[model samples]
Target: MNQSSTPQVPFWAHLLCGWPLFLVAVGGAVGGGLGGLAYGISISIFKTNVPMPVKIIAPVFIGMAAVVLYFVIAVAIFTAIQ
Candidate 1:
């Protein structure tokens, strides 16, 4: 087929290839930051006994888990669409 006449890859192809990774990276960063912020605020406001490192690390780990969950969901949806 001529290059111009060839069918372009569907939008979903790009989404399937890239969107989950992007979302996870973004979600992890956001979740980590928010988690740290919330921990800091709670510690200052409520005087929680949790350690600073735990507060900072918990969110990052949770965020990573969330990203994995998100990927699974996305894959399911993508499969259904196909």
Candidate 2:
């Protein structure tokens, strides 16, 4: 077997960077999922019982709130862990 002449990267560097990056990625995914879930719930809740303006506006606000909440929570958790 012939060995390539390219330099090898250190494992510690990969570990140090990889874990946090992985966590951040997972956090973002979870956050987006939770936001979508909140949007769905908000849609169900606002479908028939609210005023037209409220029906149009409340879910958007709710989804935004959910996304912000998720982002904050995820960052907090990631920071805490690291």
Alpha carbon lDDT of each predicted model: 0.47, 0.55
Alpha-carbon RMSD of each model: 19.5, 18.7
| Per-model TM against the reference | 0.42, 0.54
Point out the worst 10-residue segment of candidate 2 by lDDT: 13-22
| Displacement of the residue 25 alpha carbon in candidate 1, Å | 9.8
Q: Lowest-lDDT window of 10 residues in candidate 1?
A: 12-21
What does the lDDT read for residue 62 in candidate 2?
Answer: 66
lDDT by residue (8-66, candidate 1, tens digit) is 54444333323224453444665444444443343333233466566445544544555
How does model 1 score by TM-score?
A: 0.42
Identify the runs in model 1 with alpha carbons over 4 angstroms from their true place. Answer: 1-47
* Model 1 alpha-carbon miss at residue 53, Å: 1.4
Candidate 1: Cα lDDT at 74? 62
* Overall local distance difference test of candidate 1: 0.47
N/CA/C clash count, model 2: 0
